[model samples]
Target: MRIFALPLVVLASFVASAAAEYSCAGPDARTQPPTGAIVVDPTGAYSGSFHNLSEAVSNVPNTTDEHTIFLFPGVYREQVLISRLNGPLVLQGYTCNTKLYAANEVTISHAKAQRDISPEITSGRNDLTSTLRLKTNDVKVYNLNVANTAGRFLENGQAVATIIEGNNYGFYACNFTSHQDTVYANKGRELFA
Candidate 1:
């Protein structure tokens, strides 16, 4: 058997490109929007504009306006995708302790995979089958938990917690839990700080 040695230049380029996808930052450096930002309180405590996350996202104009979605303490069992916002967007979770991902109180969860659903049903995009999918650039998610309960050992395959396919995306103090493809950040330059 002959050993094929990879070129040093190619190895260095791969390492550099991979390093560009990550960053290190303190919890204080996380994006902290104002309290007056658009709130999504399921208990009707904060007088939110919409009770559902999808509705709140849909209400935002797809223009160059900076928008933020503050999710109060709730277990949102829905599939959310942010695809057509032409501006910077922020999704922040309500947490008693913002310094750590463990204190996150908002959970956006779902259970679906390509093995269980037909390709046509998923619009031929298996990436969209995630619980949370972001297809727009300049997006930030902070202090939230995104989960896919579908077990990898089960017959269903390829369950994804969240899919980040956009550029300039940052996830700070966020917990993404799943058996497989917990956080699919395969497409763009992402920062999981």
Candidate 2:
């Protein structure tokens, strides 16, 4: 009986240590401004004047709490990756046509090289890669167009617009238009159009 009890105690200690490593930046501990009216703009006064979408996401709080990151009108030229830890995040553009452009040409040929190749590929013209990669659950995006302008002149490479890798994500009034992999929704459950 004593030996069995000792093993149980050791198992409990291990479980506690593992749980501590899983830190979710809970709803109550938001480091950024609340989601109600957070905005990102080059001319605005905020924690950081983000010149691109990636900078905006970097400032967002990673937690289960719901928060919104509003982007102003501008052409954001960069690859944006939204992490899985930031669930219930929202990225909204001020206008319907606000655009996020990708610098890298997304191509099955090129993507394969990186081992991050997208599943869908089109005629060297319409590869489905967009400029944005979303990996969080329950995220919402609205009124923005994600595009890859790399192959526009060369007509070889493609662009991946948006990659959704989490569950319960939603996109409303958002336009994902790219020459290649437009939107990559991977293993996500209950994604709203």
Candidate 3:
């Protein structure tokens, strides 16, 4: 019995390519922004002017539909505040390895602490230094890093990397770094996957 080998070879090559792209699937997945997501890129590589996390988070419309904000590779030096959303929100960072936090390329950082915050903050002093504050529920964050650049207990105090005040929050392959008080999820059911 003579079996044609060309079909088998082509199938093998197709499977090999698909397996190799498992880490970063989808067309132009590593280079293009995700569809239906608000893109944030500091280099102005995206179509919109949502160059900063602060700008993108604030502009999210209050709707019942699921929304997502995609961040490109960069260190965004600003505070990110996610207000109460009527629906679910997703904050995703561009990463080659979506399952590893160490490979995250998007970082939201701020060099401030409780002492640096003004009296205008009404969420109590504990939240004054948080670089990223999520006040809404049903949020998913992936492959992102948040850092409070305040010095350790010596010169700075209570520099929080993130503060989540909402329920049903999922943070996957994300890193929160700071000198003190890295993350505060006092009033929420959070999952760190």
Strongest candidate by TM-score: 3
- Comparing 2 and 3 by lDDT, which wins? 3
What lDDT is reached at residue 163 by model 3? 92
Put down candidate 3 lDDT per residue, 22-128, tens digits, no spaces: 54655424445667888898989677858898888888888899988889999999887888999999888888777778868899998887778676875677676
Per-prediction CA RMSD (Å):
13.7, 17.9, 7.0
| Candidate order by decreasing TM-score | 3, 1, 2
TM-score per model over all chains: 0.77, 0.58, 0.81
Top-down lDDT ranking: 3, 1, 2
Clashes of each: 0, 15, 0
Tens digit of per-residue lDDT, candidate 2, span 11-58: 999998877643323432223334464566655656655656677677
183: Cα error in model 2, Å: 1.4
RMSD of 1: 13.7
- Candidate 2: C-alpha lDDT: 0.57
> Which 10-residue span in candidate 2 carries the lowest summed lDDT?
103-112
Over the stretch 68-144, how does candidate 1's per-residue lDDT look in tens digits? Answer: 88887889999998785789998988775667797677899888876767656645345756899888889888889
lDDT of all predictions: 0.77, 0.57, 0.84
